[model samples]
Target chain A: MNPSAQHQDAEGARLGMWLFLFSELLMFGGLFVVFAVYLQRYPAQFADAGRQLSLFFGTGNTVLLLTSSLTVALAFEALRQNRQRLCQGLLGFTILAAGLFLVNKGLEWHAKFQHDLYPGSQTLRQAPAGQELFFGLYYLTTGLHGLHVIFGGVILSWVLVQVRQGRIIATRPTMLENGALYWHLVDVIWIFIFPLYYLLL
Target chain B: MGKVIQMGEYFRRGFLEPSGKQPALFDWIFSTDHKRIGLLYLYSICTFFAVGATIGLLIRLELIAPGRTIVGPQIYNALFTLHGVIMIFLFIIPGVPAAFGNFLLPLQIGARDVAFPRLNLLSWWLYIFGAIMALSALFGGGGAPDTGWTFYLPFAGETTTNVSLAVFGVFVLGFSSILTGLNFITTIHRMRAPGMTWSRLPLFIWSLYATAWVQVLATPILAITLVLILSERVLGLGLFDAARGGDPLMYQHLFWIYSHPAVYIMVLPPMGVVSEIIPVFARRPIFGYWFVAASSIAIAAAGSLVWGHHMFVSGMSDTAVLVFSLLTFIVAIPSAVKVFNWVATLYGGSIRLDAPMLFALTFVLLFSIGGLTGLILGSAATNVHVHDTHFVVGHFHYTMFGGGGFAFFAALHYWFPKFFGRMYNNRRATWAWGTMVIGFNLLYFSMMVVGMHGMPRRYYDYLPQFTHLNQIATIGSWILALGMALMAVNLLIALRRGQHVGANPWEAATLEWTVASPPPPENFEELPQVSHGPYDLKRAGEA
Candidate 1:
């Protein structure tokens, strides 16, 4: 193929990725629509469930994700400057923060498990039926978010190795740019999930 | 003269060097070329259609008698559910768009391939995998999903069957559809030839653009909605269980939000296809070109807002019902506008009633009937009485079968030359079209009268009062199925005996027609730089 054709193909590839991201937003948006409708249906229970959630961990993960998003953005800048080591280092830090968010999520879910709030548990004998609904949603929303964090961590780690090996370059860093975009989306989803799951107490 | 190579020399290329050995299986498995991948989707979705159609045939066959015939009522419920699920999700929704749209969109727009071809391949694979999962659910401890495709709550959540796996299959299919939509939207925006501006592109491309938008924007809501339904079933969650204080009506709202636009997703591409075929056989440019294109976008935009029409009698507020009913009628205007424009394009023109034109003309007539009937259903009062009756089922088939089905035929006839590089016998083609149009109306139209007389839909049997109409519908289905069988035979026979195709078979001006039939691996020998609108046949000499 012609070199100009290759350039045009690359542009199409980039635009395709952005459109894919837009779809990802809607896929998750479906879950959010359910959340909004359910909130209207069970406003008191949903808010009460939020009060029981650990705001401390939720806030901590939010700040951690926000900072990691900044680091990923900075790594894209470093790659543009051809500072491969700086880019790798920033990507590594971003991965570490994502891992930290996941570990906290695990601890919080475990604490809920210990309290016998998991959906199938029989320990919550008082108001046992509809109460399970609240925890069911909690697991679903946070579990999907956790899946994204794990996916983002894998992608960032790959980008780090690529940056260290001199594969991603200044002008040809679509891989890095897309990875950063994915991480930012993860952070942005958390921005909404935080209020719905933990805040509004 | 040019030293030598004559017409027969060009004709010999498709054979003798036909590459008898399958291009490495990996060529198909990992294909990044859009045309090959499009064929891959066409074949896979055809397999799904066969399965769905087989289920449909059985359901119709069983309904021939008032009582259970070959299968019991329990199995009958599951049969229709699978029929609806497989047909709606696997076949019709992806029918023209993924199969023909993917095959032609890039070529029509003068691009080398889609914006992202690997994702295109992945979408097909995902659809296959989802279909397999859905099919395998039959062997689970309980029978496959007995709840309808909607999987309405209480039935969905409280059912003892393996609804979870079935729902999972639907979710994956929805994901596949969303990805395909994303690819088309990006390709349309970024991959047009240098001079192929949006307004000048073909109407089929415009319809695809609108369908893709809905796929990207609305399909995800269905994904999450099904997920909530699945979890509620598996984990005893109370998301949509009314007894558990969750509103079942919310499920209807969420489901219709995606599924309603989904009707447009199925029809719009075919409408775009008819728009292309009509003018070609009429020997004139399409009338109200902008109106046809705008109608596509308008249908897409208006289609999304009127999902409330589906829930008009599901205990929604009266004001909400009124608003939705009005919007439903408003949405019909664009579809009506498209029908009128196609008719006018045929006016004052020399019309050749070839197979493609026959199907296109049939589309104009049938879609008008379907759209007009949709107006009756859109009224709140009529909807309240006929909410779950055969009337609704008849309305759906009128649009899906009448609009989507006829448009699909129009496309098949229009693009057969390009796809297989051959054309079917025109006489057989015309016969097939005639049988299909008559059989389709007989099958679905009778249901409308039966339903109006108070026969509910989705029932295993009806009262004696509705027996006559039901018998007519059942008999009509046989004719309709026979017509479908005839079409299948004709299409298969065309593969071998159809007329040899040319670079531009119809002499219809479009970027796709500029290339060889069944096009080469790269689509073009040299990329075309466009300078005018696609259908400007008169300007061909100038270009």
Candidate 2:
């Protein structure tokens, strides 16, 4: 095939990536719908539970993820300009930011665990009915989002290696584009999670 | 053209010839060729079908007498659970699209492969892995899941059986389903031949396109529902636990949301197949081609919202029931439109009673009965009468098995020569088809009658009043099994020793018929430019 054909292939790959992202949005959309229903059913209890979630850590992680998204986007731009060193540095920074976000998430979850707010914990077992439901949704939604963070971090790391090997250059940048798209998705989901879990209080 | 000369070189090499570097096993297992991957799906799905069929036989035998004849209640519950899981998830859901869609989609579209061939292979591997995980539930833990394939919560969460593993396996299978949808959607969008416009595409491709959308959009809800079930079972989460302020009805809402659309996922491709086979064998341009294609999209869209009809008897509010009942009735219109067009296509045409045509005709009749009975179940008042009765079971089987299952057979026989370059014994195939249809009606129609007389489903032992009909149903199952055996044996023999056939054995007008029987690795010697609709028999005759 010719360069135009390869370009068409790249176009199709981007379309496929967008469709995959739609599915990802719906997966989290299911949880958000669940959260909305529960919040309506127990507004006071949800507010209380929301307050218990550490706002400081949530805001900190949000900043980290937003910055990471910026760096990955910049990495893509660097690759487009054929600045390999700049692209690598930006990606490394993105990975570092993702790691810090996860660490902050760990600290927040640890505090919850210390307070015995985990699902099925003895404290949760004795918690008010609506509170139990609130915490349950909490763990399920945030845990799933955290897994995406880890996946996004690992994918960026792989793209970094591919860039170093000259495979993800300006002319052939589909892999880098997809990786950055994934990282942006992770950041976007955290933006939703931060409000629904922490800022709602 | 340059492409034609390149393909001619490949034609000389032959698709089946293994290169010197790789072993045959590695060549096949690791092959990303869409045709080979399709065949892999065929073999695996058929094996799972056999296992599921045997389990169905056991369930029918146990229902033969008033009391247990073949198994205890506990064993019986497990048997039906395994039957439902294997048949629905493993066999029927992926049956037509994965096997035939993978094999024929590229050929029909005049493309060499799907948009993402490697991802296609990954989907198949995930399919196998999910199947293994599901089967593993049978050996370990408190026996296989007795929560039914629906895995209605409370019981699912409370069951000591291997529900979690089985549910997780389904989660994995959902990934495979989603990826296939993503691949097919992209292929249809990007890979059509130079002149193959959207309006000129075959009806099967249109239906697959609609089915692909459903698979991509609706499957995630099922995935999330399964994950919640697993979480509830393992972590004792209160998501669906009524004791913890969670509503069990919410679980039903989420489960049926995906599953009801999933019914379309299972049947639409087969409907597409019937649409393809009917016009060809009837020797006519399809009646209202645009209408038939549009109805497929209509069905897919309307089908998603009518899911709440399944919850009519679950104590939902009356207003909700009324709304759902109206939507359910609306969804039936598109299906009726397709059936009408199919019947109209057969009018005033020179018809051939080939085996595929026979199954297609059977599909129309059986699917109509299924669709008509669906209205009764769709109504709020009538559904209350026959909510969990065997009527529901019979209705679904008629649609899924009678409609979808027969269409699969039709596609199999119709494409056998094209796929394998050999012809099966037509006389034996017809006989098998006759006996199978007879046995199918005798078995399921009886269940509908008995269910009207108040016989519930999933009962290992029934009242003595239902015994005689149950016995008749069991006998029908035996005949059904016999017919299935004959069909399998005939196809196997033909696969190995049947007479060689040339391309275009049926004198059909589809793009697939224009290619060689068992088409080359790259499909076409030259990509044929489309100048007419898929069913333009007059144009085909001139060629």
Q: Best-fitting candidate, measured by TM-score?
A: 2
- Expressed as tens digits, the lDDT of each residue in B283-328 for candidate 1 is 8898999999999999999999999988877799999999999999
Model 2 chain B is weakest, by summed lDDT over 10 consecutive residues, at B1-10
Worst 10 residues of 1 chain B by lDDT: B11-20
- The lDDT of each candidate is 0.82, 0.89
Candidate 1: give the clashing pairs: none
Top-scoring candidate (lDDT) = 2
What's model 2's lDDT at A103? 92
How well is each residue in B188-245 modelled by candidate 2, as lDDT tens digits? Answer: 9998988899998999999999999999999999998998998898888878888889
Q: Show where candidate 1 strays beyond 4 Å.
A: A1-10, A120-125, A128-132, B1-9, B12-25, B540-543
Which pairs, if any, clash in model 2?
A: none
Model 2 misses residue B150 by how many Å?
Answer: 0.5
Per-prediction fnat values?
0.55, 0.51
Evaluate residue B445 in candidate 2 and report its C-alpha lDDT on the 0 to 100 scale: 92
Candidate 2 residue-wise lDDT, A1-201, digit = tens: 111223248878988898888888888888888889889998988898888888788888888888889989999999999999999999999999988988988888898999898878888778777888988988898899999999998999999999999988999899999999999899888888889888776
Interface RMSD, all models, one decimal each?
3.3, 3.4
